[model samples]
Every structure is written in structure tokens, then in C-alpha cells.
Target chain A: MASGNKTTLLFYPSTTNVSAKIHPVVLFNICDSFVRRPDQAERVIGTLLGSVSADGIVEIKNSYAVPHNESADQVALDIDYHHTMYLSHQKVNPKEVIVGWYSTGSGVSGGSQLIHEFYSREVSNPVHLTVDTGFTNGEASLKCYVSFNLSLGDRQLAAQFQEIPLDLRMIEAERVGFDILKTTVVDKLPNDLEGMEATMKRLLALIDDVYNYVDGVVEGRLIPDNNIGRFISNTLSSLPKISPATFDKVFNDRIQDNYALVYLSSLARTQLSIAEKLNTAAQVL
Target chain B: MANTMARSFLQAVATEEVAPPLRVVQMEGLAVLKIIKHCKEFSPALVTGQLLGLDVGSVLEITNCFPFPTREEDDENEADGANYQLEMMRCLREVNVDNNTVGWYQSTLLGSYQTVELIETFMNYQENIRRCVCIIYDPSRSNQGVLALKALKLTESFMDLYRHNSFIGEKLREKKLSWVDIFEEIPIKVSNSALISAFMTELEPDSPVVQCDLDRLKLSTAPFMERNLEFLIECMDDLSSEQNKFQYYYRNLSRQQAQQQTWLQKRRTENIARKAAGEEPLPEEDPSNPIFKPIPEPSRLDSYLITNQVANYCNQINGAAGQSFSKLYLMKALQDN
Candidate 1:
């Protein structure tokens, strides 16, 4: 849990043919378990967190264990023994455990996109816990971690962690903005998780833009007419996409249709224009 | 003065010794003489003229103290009834002589009996004359006239009661007083004799009027019996029996009507055909077709099926509670296995 010890668990495309096919690679640093119960550990590690073939073959090329004690040369071996004991009691193969982890992580990633879209409005960051490895008793055991942009004075640190994906981290940031719009448009339309997220994102962006524009006007940075026209024009362009004549009717017929995506994009564009005008006025004033 | 002249005229007619002679006198001539003679006080002049054999002026004065007689008193003086009648006629004639010649007669003795006497005498002498009307025209003395008129009506109503009492006596015989009493106490009277006869005919068993009354009474009473009996029978009968009976009766009636209509139509058609062919038509028989049968009662199995379906739906809802995600997934896994 310490900030310095929290390392990023990266799962990029590797050089090996088998590893390249795996879109996500999960690393679990297993040791003697204490906190997690036998059942919880089985559910987390024994099941595929991401992708797994039907035949249940899970290939892990290389796994490293960063031990807290330098004297423990057989740290990987000890971790494997604990993992085998957990899996054996669960009556599942080690391969199935790896595959289950891969599948589960993939599923979580898909779910995070929806969450990302939803909370995009107010969230500074959206961090998802990707299981890099199985739970272990030692401090150095891989556990859940969230990614965030580290701003050090004038420099921006774009860091990705193994536990949390970059897409989910961005989604978490978007979720904060989504929360604001959710308050306004609760009962107006369908709020299936993804649909609500998309709507929230669009609405929050618009509101943020309007807020910036009004701030500029109050500060006497921009002419009132210019600010009003910028807000109005952007609003008008955003309207036709969400209106019944265009996306709404098609969305009502089939919610999974791409109209929602198109509508959200259009709304975002209009909101950005308004936000830029407001930011400009704010800076000028 | 006009009343004084009437008295004088009555006196002259009574003493004339002529046997009810038909006489006519012009009112215009009498009215002029009345104005000339009654220019001064004329009360004593009227009394003296009536007592003596004086051909007094047409105008004579009289007081309002003349004694009004009762009907019973007039009956007692029945021998002088014709003379009294003749005197009243002469007085009426003298009053009628001039349309503008006003007459007045008043008495504190104007009670019910006295009013009856006046009405009887007037009716006796002027029954045939449609224009011989009497008016109690006293606008200023309204209360007095109204009370007297009310008393007079009551006395006349009692007389009618007595008359009806007598008529009932002859018909009812030994039933006597009670019957007569009841008849006399009846609130309404037969103002028109024809209406009475028509009402009585309804009571006569052999009359068509009685049949018409019976028909009306039956029409009114039949619906009450039908509704009550039908309701009782409906409650007693099972649902199936009720439905079957209703369908059977409906079907039977519909079939009968259809048959009758078809027969009539066929006859009409044959008659028209015969007329066109210049020949007589043949006698037709009523068409015979199988009567519509009522639908059979629903089977117990059908009822069972409906009940089972409802029970199954209930069970499905009840069973939904026990299945958790693990159990559901386990079940799916087992099924797949």
C-alpha cells in the first residue's frame, strides 16, 4: 500500500508468439496468504481474470518475484507452492487459474469503459484494479493498484500501473464529470450503465463550458454577446444529434446501435468549443 | 228606489186577480218615472204603496229591513208558494225593465237557511231561463259575503248528503243507517252522472270495461312475479343448469319464430307466383329443420388445466427466491456437463 513500493504491473505485447496473442498479461506474486480466506483466494486467483482458450491452456512465459528478503533465493518456488496448494484445494489446474485471471481482467476492462464514460465529467482520474498477480502475505506481493498522472511542479508524469489500465484510469477521471450531469438528467432518459455514462459525459462537458463562459463574463474578460453566441451556437449544433429526429429514435429502437457513440462525440465537440472560449476568456481576464 | 219599485210591482201582481198573465213593460219608460218620483225620500212611500192599492210612481224607496225567509219556512207556506213565485217573477221583471236601473236587498238574517230559500225560489221561477243569473256583488262588504257564502255551501252540501242518504235507503234496505252514513260521508261526489256509470262498469264482471281493467292490473303485476320468481329460480339452479335452460328456451323460441316467418314468406311467394301464372296456389307445410342444441358443459379436465396453469405460475414466482448466482451458474455448468 506504500506509494514508493507500488510498482506499475505492465502487460504489453511481448516478443514471443504465444505472449503476443495475449492482449493482457497478469502477474501475481504469490506467497504465504494471510488476509484472504481460502474461498476468496480461489475466486480471485483460480478463475481466469482475462482471456483463456476453451481447451483451458494458459501460457505464462516469464514471472519475476521481487522478494523483500534478499536471502530468499527460492521466492518464486515458495510462491508457486502456495499457489498450487490454493488451486489444488479448489480442484482447478494452474493453467485454468491463469486463464480465469486473464478472462476476468478482460471483463473488468470492458466494464471500466462504461464506468469511464459515466464518471468522465467530474473525475480527475478513473483507476481500475487489474490483478497483476495472486495475493501473497509478504509486503512485496503483487496486489491491486490504481494509475494516476503525477504532476511534479512543471512536469507531468504519465505513468501506467500493472494493476490499473490507462484506459480505466482515464475513465475514472471522466467519471467525476459524469457524476455532475447524472444529478441533472436522472429521469429524462434510459440510464443503462453505459447509456447513462455517455449522457453524463455530454452534459457535464456542456455545463463546464457554460460555467467557464459565465465566469469570463462576470470577470469582464469577454464581451457578453460573444460569450452568449459561442454558448448558443455550440448548444444548437449539439442539439440535433441528441434530438428525436436523429440519434434518439435509432437509440430507442436498438440501444446497442452506434448512434449513441456518434451523438456523444458531437456533444463533446460542441462542449469543447464552448469550454475553450470560456478558458480563453478566463485566462485573459 | 229600484227595490221599492220591485216591491210595489210584486204587490200589484199579487192583487191583480189575473191568472198569471204574460206581461211586458218597457224598462226605459219605467226608469224615467222612477227618477222623477224618488227625487225625495221614498221609504214610507214604498211601504204605503204596497199596503194600499196605489199605482205608485215607478220609483219607490225601501229600507234594508225586509225579512229573509228560510227554505223550510217557504215549504210550510206551500199553499202560498205559487203566489210567492208570481211575486218574485214580477219583481225580477221590474228590475229587468232597465239595464241601468240598480236594485238592492239586504238583511242581517242572510244565514244559510235563508240563502237556500232564495236559491230554491230563484231556481223555481227562472230554471228555464239561462240568462237568469244571481250575483252577490258586494265588493265593500266582502268578509260578510264570504262567510255567508261558505255557510251556504255547507248547508247545500248537507242537503246533498240527506238526498244521497234517502237514495241509499231504498237500495240498501236493512243495512240502513250505516250504509247511508257511509255514502253521505264520501268526500267526492258524482258531479257528472256519465262518469259515475263508466267507473261502475269496470266493477261489473260481464262488462268489457272489467276485462280492460283486469288486463291493466295483470300487466302491472306480472313483471313483479316474473322478476322475483326468476331470481329465486336462478339462485337455486346451478350455473350449468341455468345456462343450459336459458340457451334451450332461447333456441326454441328463435326456432319457432323462424319457422313461422319462413312459412309466411313461402306462402306469400306461392301466392304471388299463382297470381302471375293465373292459377291457385298449393297449401304449404311448415319447414322442418333440426333445432339448435345448447353447447355442452365444460369438462372437469379443462378446469383442472386452468387451475394448474395458475398454480404453476405461482410456483415459478415462489421458486425464484432460492436460486443465487452460484447456484444458477452451478446449474448452468451442470447442464453443460
Candidate 2:
């Protein structure tokens, strides 16, 4: 839909469910492509592949970088390369349709509209995701936008990029990997026990924070919010009742069974090593 | 200075003669996240992808990865899989990404990844890549607050034995390679660029304990433990059957030995009679006798895979139980206080 306007017309998509859900993998891919970009290239751009549900929620699942050349006045995209990459990606994930395109920079630049138009030709309405890969404002700001086609009299090609709500969602395994990636100073990946220890420590810190907040509110040093109070109470109530005696008995019994198997495995391993040694000795003989 | 140069040259030669074993698998954070997303998104249905990176000395650096096409969707032609991989790698190379296939990664369900299929995939990769590893990620285990990602490779001795296709008892004995020697695990190291680390730090929510951390506090791990136990029992049964096959082979071999002994004695008697009669005796070894036929020894590959799977399940159960114990104790203390 277009309107003859002298300036610009900002219009949202017809559907009310216009929000976008972005997988952390897409962000990781964008950042990676940005890092591996050519030395002279100022920014890297790629096509976002996902599916639009019946409810109209756009889920961006996967992406691959598309090579392009741009300058102050001229912009050119490798349409052939984009087509081939899309076909190959489709062969892998047939369901992941081209939903939008992403670029790495401070925000949407002047040449983004041309790329967005190219993607729009592929899909109905393409989203434009601009990642602040440079961390210009001391943080990498991730922003997603859906464009509105504004008909400005004779300039019927112009469009405006409108910001849309986007959330970073990941599965359980991804969160664990993300947590591990957060530790940049320690390059070594944590073992299971170390992960558990860190988790416990974080839990303990949280408990202390909650306890302090309650204490402050009770002592009248801070105003108690009813919403937080209900939230804390609800959490406490959700915990199942546990009698110390019953729990101890169940816990000990389960732990003993588990430890017994652990011991059995250890014993099996010892016998294996011994058997290997014996076999080698007999072979030599 | 001349002496130093000579010593350096000698050391270089020594290093070339004995290349270092892959002790650490250095994976980029981008690769790690990419793998997690791909595997978890398709979850219950297992998926695999090609790993691209360099093989540095003593460290296998994984830089990037792309998911493989689902078999059913790959135009129903098996050859398309290889073509897709080649085209994808070529496209990625054009984008300045690492296209060298270092290894491949696959998602596993409940740590049950040890299989002959996996080994076959490894042998296929071995043809081109000088040294490679298979990275196994178990999403089910990670759900229990454990990041179960491991890098595994075929041991040199085991690979040598595998190439001969002779996995007999004697062959294994000669190689001194037990079932445990089939796969060697290299420790994994995860490192992120400064900018990614900063971005991840920003991704962190205001709360110290996110949803995953809260999920760790969940006390009900009985389902996970139960599934692991079920798999363990099945493995034990399979292992016992394998043992029985070996037993049957041994029995047949012993009977054949006794038959040979009797046949040799008769032939000796006949020869002695012929000597007395001044006539030639028949040959002792009979090629057509069914009793003298060789009984083929069964392959230990099946048993080795089962044992590996069993050990994997055991470790998983132990880890989940241990984590649960910690959480329970913390909860108990919190209540008491």
C-alpha cells in the first residue's frame, strides 16, 4: 500500500503480532562474519533465514554472509552469490525461508535500503536487522526493524525503517555455552564440577541479595514493593515441603545407589587396564 | 651463534619426526554458539554439520561450522549431501571464512553417540583431513546443568587395526588396544574475541541467576536418571550377547582342534602301515573336511561401542546425581535457616 506524500509515510505491518524473536546463533553469526570480513570492507551483511508462524511471529534461525561492494554513492550486491547461498541453505533447512537481511555497523546506513529492497523481492516484507558490531556506545546494541514503504510523490521507491521489538531466545544447551563464552579471561572450558560450583555460588549471591532487600524493607530503610513481596512469597510457597528426616533417608539411599554404580564403573575400568596389561604380557611371551 | 643455529635445526628435525598429539581442542565462541543453536533447534532429531578451522600443533582450532542437510530433504539423493557441503564451503571461502574442514560435529540424545556409524564417518573424513576430531554435544545432558561437549578421535593403534578389518581376539591382543582405546578424548578449550565477550556480557540480564540457573535448582531429576538407567540396562544386555558370541566361537574352535588331533593320529597309523607294506600313504591334511573349516571370529567393534556407550551413560548419571545432591543440600540449608 502506498500513499502520495511529499515527506514520508510510516506504516506498521497489517498484523498485530509484528514482533521478531532472534536466536542467539544469528547474532553470533553476524558478529563472526563481521570479524572475518575483508580488511577494506567497513561492514558485513548477510541474509536472515527463518519462518513466519501463523501468529505472525518472525523467528530468525540461521544466516550466512553475502559479499557486497559499497561506497559513498554506489552500492552493488552479488545477486548470483546470494541466490546460490540461499538455495544451498534451503537444501539443508527447507523450512528456513529468507525472512530478512542483517548488517553490521552502528545502525542502518544509506545503502541498507537497497539491500532491503533486494531481500523484499525474495520475501513479502523483509526485516532489516542492524547490529552495532563496533560497540560505538560502549555496548554492542542489537536492533531490528521492519520497513514501511513511503510513497513520496514522484519518488515512489523510498521507504522508512521502523524499529520492531526483538528478543534474544536460546535453548538450555545454548545458555550453558553462552555462560561459558562469557568468561573471556579464562580460556579453559569448565568441567562439570566447576560449572556446578559457579552455579551454586551465583545462587548463593542471589539469596543474599534477596535477604538483604527483605531486611531493608522490614527495617523501614527502604519502601517495600507489594509486587516484589508477592513474587518472593510465591517462590517460597512453590517449594515442596521436605521433612529433614525423610529427605535425609531418601537422599542417602539414592546417593549410595549412585555411588555404588560409580564404584562399579571404576572397578570395571581397573580390571580393563589389568586385562590389557596381561594380554600384552602374554603376547610378548 | 653457529652452535645455537645447529641446535635449533636439530630440535626442528626432532619435532618433525614426532608431531605432538592433539592435547587441546581450541574452539571459537562463535562456533560453539553456532553448534548449540543448530543442534538444539532440531533437538530430538539428530543433526550434523561440517567443522572448518586449522589444525595447529597440539591444538585443533575450530573456527566455523555449517549444518548438514537433513537426509529426507536433500533431494532424496545421498550424493547431494557431499555436493551441498562442497558448495557451502566454496561460498564461505568467498566470504573470507575458514573453509578447511577440520572435523564435524553431531548432536546426541542422552549421551548415546557411540556407534559404528560415527566411526564410519570418521574413517571417511580421515581420507582427506590428516588429523580430525568428532565433537559430540549432548543437549539432553546440558538441560541438567551440564555442558556435555567432548572431542573424540580414533586412536592410531585402533585405526591401524580397523584398516585391516581384523578385529579378532589375537589381533586386539597384539595391538594391546582394549575397548577403551578406540576413542581418545582431547580436552576442549573455549575462547571468545574481546568484542564477543563484551557483547555476551551485555546479553547477561540484570539477575545473577537466569532461567538456566533456576532450572539447575529444579529438584526433580528422576526422569533423566530413569532414562539413563534404561539405556544402561539395554547396553548391558547387548554386551552379554556379544560375550556369548565369543564363547560360541571358542567352543567351536576347541572341537575343531580335537578333530584335527584324531585325524592326525589316524593318518600316522596309515603311513606306518604303508611303510610296512612298502606303499605310499594318503595325505594327512584334508581340505574338504567340514571339521577342519575355520570359524570366523566376531568383530569386537560392536562390543567396544556398547562399552563406550555404557561408560558414557554412567558418567552422565553420576554428574546429574551429583548436581542434584548439591542443589538439595542448598535448599535444605536455606529452609533450616
Candidate 3:
């Protein structure tokens, strides 16, 4: 398929080409940036930092907004600021580079093409991403587009912005966080006690998995791999060896310390109020 | 340090001494997601919900919302609608959430949201809550790869005209309102709390799934573009007819004004001749004056709405076509290389 030498454009379909890999963190950042701007009408623009792979997977790792409305000069300044920020971030995490740009909402609006053109100058085949911040539904949706300018006869240019697929890649921790976030979507949060119990249950499940593996090997039903043996040893060694009585005492002391801190803060607050009253009285006198 | 900065910033903006230029609508991530869920759940059937939040001056923070149960013949079930909303609010209050009705939400299909039903709903909301907005969620469009969430509110002029129950062109012209000005699209911000931010960070490690998934990235443009083109064609026909209707009214209005002017001139000349001839002038029988006085100018509200809907359709076509064009370009470029 790659070696096809067909020169005619009519027969080639667009399905085989471009795709994108968006890090979960990029979305979290986009949402956070949006949340920071409470004024609803303000247009938020941001640069997406990531790299496009040879196979055309645009991996977007990080993003930050360009604040509220800015003057033309300010927009230039913002681009510079974002460039520097991206450079500094790249120093820390070098895998991601500039892949595209993103904004809030669904389809391309009046000025999207202009913005896409500007981004095109920054990177070849710049991906235009729109994150549906308007959670019209229970999930934030993301749309990626790659724009190209086709020359119609006599130097007339027609720009096309096509939607590309975005794949969200998350680490295990991110998956857990996403699950927790999903739970919040139902607007239900388990109380602290329930949360603690859930955490314990998950921990027990992990232990049960390890227990089964060990039980199988001991019963000669399965041969233990070096990875499993090493994992078991590491887990056993990392286990804390505290007596029940000592553990109980430590937990009680920590709780007492937290209570004391709360009491001291309240005392401080009252003292500050009294001092303020005294200062006002002295001034009146 | 960050917490204190945020706290102080909140304190600084606490007092909204004057009406802010634009009302800020802050929505929690959960609330937004819930709206999307509701919209998707009731696909094809219209879904509506009451926005629960605190409205502090210019800031309308939508902390929560609850969907109105599906009811048959919503117009006849007005009492049922109110009861359902009240029931939901009461439940939210019991849960100690923000229960004030800041606005409402409706799921639209492919930006086909401009309609009489929507306007009526907006009018009702505006009458009760001055700052109420209608969040239009288009699940179908969103499914095509973008989240179609828009916060729209009827402009003050449109609301006033609707309140006066006047759809006359003269009245609308007096207000200097156009179809485009009827509904103002407010920018939307989806916010998460500090806790959620911290949790997102905590979720960053040992994420289990890693795959170069290509299924989502494929550009499937035919059905979407075809649908937009079809809707655009429909809108074009409707728009032309709407224009014709407006033109018919304007033509009649001008003709009426012209006939009245000519009659008044003729009556003045006759009165002068009668005075000169020492005879009482014919009793003023102005057929055009009283008859057309009460005839309110035909309101362009519907036409304006149609025009706006047409523009929306045009935009969809433009975007979808642009996308399909780019896809072809990619294909051609790949083939050439």
C-alpha cells in the first residue's frame, strides 16, 4: 500500500493516513485551564506540545491556555511565552514536541481557519484539536483535525479542515483517576468511610492475586517464573513489621495530633479577631 | 501558596458592585458530563434539565443539574413539568447541593436547535430568571467527533419584544435587533476543583493501557458531510421562502404607506377647493389610516430564526466540506509520495 504509484487523487481514500495519540494529562490540563477561566465568553486558545510519528500518530502530551482576550501584540507575546514554556517542559520530558493546537467547543467557527493557518506555520501538518468543554453529555469529547490548503486554478486557495481520530493513552494511575472522575460524573462521591473501605477492598484483591499465584506454584500445578518469584520477594520484604499494639498507639497519637492542630487553628483565629477589635478600639480612643 | 492566591482572588472578586459586562457561567466537570450523559441517554427524544447553581451577580456557577422526566405532550403537561422540576430541586436541596435554577439545557440534533419551542422555553426562563441561559447539547454532532455544547441566551431586545408580544417589523426595527442578535452564544468554561486536579495528577503513574490505536483516528467523512449537505439544501429552501414571506410583508407595507400619502394629499386639495367654493369639504373618510394603524407590523422573529438556522447549516457544510477536502488532499499526497 505504501509503494502504490497512483498519481490520480480521485481513487485514494483518506482513511489510511493520519491518527493521533493524546495523553490523558493533556486533557486534564485543558479542563483545568478552562475551569480557571470562569468568565464564560472568553475565548481560550492553547498550543499542544507533542510529536507526530512517522506512521502519523500525533501524540499530544501537554497543553496550556493563552489566557483571556489579548491584543494583537499580546497574542504574539503569548505565543512567545508558550514557546518558552514548551521549551522548558521539553527539557524535562523530551518525548513530546509541538504537534498541534487546541481550543474549546465542537466545530470550526469563523476564525478557526485563520488560527489553523497560524499553527500551520509552526508545524507541518498541524493538528487542530477541539475539546468539548461544554459537557453537553457526561464526558468531555475531543476532536482532531488536520488542515491543508488546496490550490484551485489561478492561485485561489481553498483550505480544508478534516476531522481525525484521537486516541487517549493513559497510564494505569490515570486509568484509576479516570474511573474516579467518571464516578464523579454521576455527581455521587462515596463518603470518607466508604472510600477507605473501597481502598482496603482493592488492596485485598491485589493480595488475593498474589496469594493465588503462590498457591498454584506450591501445589505444583504451575511453574513459577523469575518475574513472579522476584515480585513476591519484593512485596514480602517491603511489608512493614509493626506489632498490633504499637500500630494502634501510633495511629491514635496521629489522630490526637490532628485534633490538636485543629484546636490550635481555631484558637489562633479567635485571637486574631480579638487583636483586630483591640486595634480598632485603640484607634477610636 | 497557590491555595491562598486562589482564595484571595476569590475574595477580591466577591463583590460584584455593578452588573458585569458579561455574565460568567462556571460549570463543574461533573455537571457538564451529566448533561452530556442525559442528552445521549435520551437520544432523538428531546431532553431538558434544570441547572442548579449559585448565581452571584454576574457569575452563574452551575454546580449541578437534573434532567426533567420524559413527558408526552409537554405543552399540555405544564403542571407535570413544574412538578418534576420542583421534585428534582427538592431532592437536590435535600442533598445539600446548589438547588437554584440558574438555567436549563436541551439536547439538540446537528445544530438544528433554532425553533419556536426553544424560543418559548427561553422566554419562560428569561421571564423568571433574568440571567437564565439555555445550554444546547447536540449529541449527534458531538458523536461525529466534537462536543456540541453551547450556552445561549435570548438577547435583551428579543426578550423584551417577546414579552410585549410584538412580532412587528417596526417594533423589532425600533429595538435595533436582528436575527443574529436574538440569541447570544456565551462562552462556556468546564472547571474541575482542586481535589479533582490533584486526583488527576495522582492518576498519572502506572497507567495500564498503552496501544497505538488507529480505529479512532480514521477519518470517516461521507455520511457526516452528506448529512450536512442535505440539511444545508433544506435550510436554503426554507431560507428563500422565509425571505419571500418577509419581502411580501415589506411590499405590502410600502404600498399601504404610499396609498395613505396619496389619499391625504388628495383630501387636502379637495378641502382647499371646497373652502374656495364656500362648501363644506367631504367628511374625512381616510380608509387607510384607522385600518392599518392597529395592524401590527409582521414580526421577523420567525424569519430571523430561519435565517440563523440557515447560517448554522451553512457553517456545518463549510466545515464538513473542508474536512472532506483535506482528507482527499492527504490521500492524494500519500499516493503521490
For TM-score, the strongest prediction is: 2
> Can you write out model 2's per-residue Cα lDDT over A1-285, one digit (the tens) per residue?
122233435445586348788877787788888888998999999899999988778988888899999999677988889999999988877888999999998777788888888888899888878889888898768888887776655577567777777876455324574667666644566777787787789877888889999999999999999999999999899876888788778777766766776676566556545644643354221
What's the DockQ for every one of the candidates? 0.00, 0.47, 0.01
- Tell me the TM-score of model 3: 0.49
Q: Please give the distance, in angstroms, between residue B326's alpha carbon in candidate 3 and its true position after superposition.
A: 3.5
lDDT of 2 at A122: 92
Top lDDT: which candidate number?
2
- Number of the top candidate by DockQ? 2
* CAPRI grade of model 2: acceptable
Question: Which stretches of candidate 3 lie above 4 Å from their native place?
Answer: A1-285, B1-17, B74-76, B198-216, B254-277, B283-295, B332-337
lDDT of 1 by residue, B1-337 (tens): 9999999999998876543321111111111111212211122221101100111132221110111122244655655544443443343222121112122222221111122344353344233431121212111111111111110111223334434443222232332222112211101000112211222222122322222122211212223223323432332243335346545754766666676678678788988999899997766553353333332422222212222222222222222211122223332333333
User: What is the CA-based DockQ of model 2?
Assistant: 0.47
Residue range A30-137, candidate 3, lDDT tens digits: 665565553543456678887777776777766655543444433332455566555544533466677778887766665676777777787777888887666545
lDDT of 2 by residue, B39-104 (tens): 877888999999999888888899898889767755457787878888888999999888788999
The 10-residue segment of model 2 chain B with minimum total lDDT is: B206-215
Q: Better model by TM-score, 2 or 3? A: 2
lDDT of prediction 3: 0.62
